[model samples]
Target: MTIIGWMIVFCEIAFWVVIVLGLMTRYIFKKKQLGIILLALTPLVDLTLLIAAGIDIYRGEVATTAHAIAAVYIGISIAYGKSMIEWADQRFQYYVTKQGEKPRKRYGIEYSKHYFKGWIRHFIAYIIGGGILVGLIFWIDDISRTQALSGVAKIWSIVLGIDLIISITYFIWPPKEKGISSGT
Candidate 1:
């Protein structure tokens, strides 16, 4: 095998090691990191196939052993990132409340006078974060250099906008208070 193939294998191995370490210890490095690492090392793996198997993964010509390994890395990474994000979010809520002053409790629409402050602002803020991530993908990758970006673009446009909005709104604005008064 060429150095590129070896590099792919090395990266794959590193991904697993990080995941195991996270699970056993901190558990922060998962899904996105996994995907990022896989994508980061994809060139190496693709190059190996180009050199050894005479196929180009970037051009979508062939699926080699490295391709399978890359797929696994993405799948596992997505799972890991999601798990980590959720874990971190829960802990973050606690940490913020514990260490910092709590924002005034969300009472009702009456108390929240600003337009969008209660509901819409929460959604917009979320989409903003997602939009930022999508923008990152566009800036970091060779969009024209690789065919894979089309898929990335398609997925991000939809999920990034909606999921980000939902996730952020849930965390930031919080659920409606059931029994509290806005104080008339």
Candidate 2:
């Protein structure tokens, strides 16, 4: 893997690590302020990745798949990071701190709604990430240097389409709840 690839991996690891530390501090150590501060730092991790990608492109390095992925990662993180953190916090509160009820699993129409919400987040990620990729392409001003970014955009667009279809299907035919009869 290239340096950018390694940086992407590092950023991902750092993002999760920060979240875990924040939650642990809040729930385990009872240091709520420090935990909030740590949780708030998730954006900084994304910013760092963005800066690195920008610098790499600015320095005339050919953009690679890793670079394109970095943009996508930032987009997804921005779009879903809060929900993800909330998800973890809920689980931690229920399982670890025993302060809250267990997070309920959605079923039937509720499950479909959950899927739709997830699809919306994915759409937001595509827009943000695609915009960044286009910006990088324009900034590079060289087709050869930006092919990887373009490819990533195309592939991500396809994925977005597929996600939408899947999300819609959940609404069209809501998943049956386990052990529930269909009046057969």
Candidate 3:
């Protein structure tokens, strides 16, 4: 198998482990699942883009496979971030209703610091993370990559690093809530 092929196998294995571990934590513990679900799907997202981008890379349509992978990571980060933000909003609404407070209709609010996260924060975070990934890819592609495995490894590491960093940031630095802000 080619270096690219081996790299794919390595990533797939890593993703499978993450998926299983996430499932165990979310399901067994009956935990809030939005973030865990996103974690589980990262590998699938990466795999899909790698296959698609590999073709373009071979054809020289993309500057490199890394470029294609970077684009895919950006897309997935945005989607996953949006989903988690929405889930948190809905969850907050449910809690408010249960507590006999009027739930913010057609908008979100931070009832508490823990519950006061904003979707726009997620949006901005994803944008910044994606920007970093794309920027690095562009930087790296300036040099010729003779060893496909090494170049692919660099790409994989970048994507994985961004994923970890973004996930941690969201987990640790969740958005602070303001007044029951509604969209105009």
lDDT values, one for every candidate:
0.43, 0.94, 0.49
Give one digit per residue, the lDDT tens place, for model 2 in 74-169. Answer: 999999999999999999899888999899988899999999999999999999999999999998999999999999999999999999999999
Residue 28 shift from truth in candidate 3, angstroms: 18
The per-prediction CA RMSD against the true structure, in angstroms, equals: 12.1, 0.9, 11.8
Ranked by lDDT, the better of candidates 2 and 3 is 2
Worst 10 residues of 2 by lDDT: 175-184
Backbone clash pairs for candidate 2 read none
Model 1 scores a TM of 0.28
Off by over 4 Å in 1: 1-17, 21-55, 58-148, 171-173, 176-184
lDDT of 3 by residue, 93-135 (tens): 3563243344453312232223323334444544544554455
Error of 1 at 51 (Å): 12
Candidate 1: worst-modelled 10 consecutive residues by lDDT = 45-54
- Residue 10 shift from truth in candidate 3, angstroms: 23
lDDT for each residue of candidate 1 in 116-173, tens digit (9 for 90 to 100): 3323433443344334334433544554433333454355457545755665555555
Question: Which sequence of candidate numbers ranks them by TM-score, best first?
Answer: 2, 3, 1
In order of appearance, the predictions have TM-scores of 0.28, 0.97, 0.30
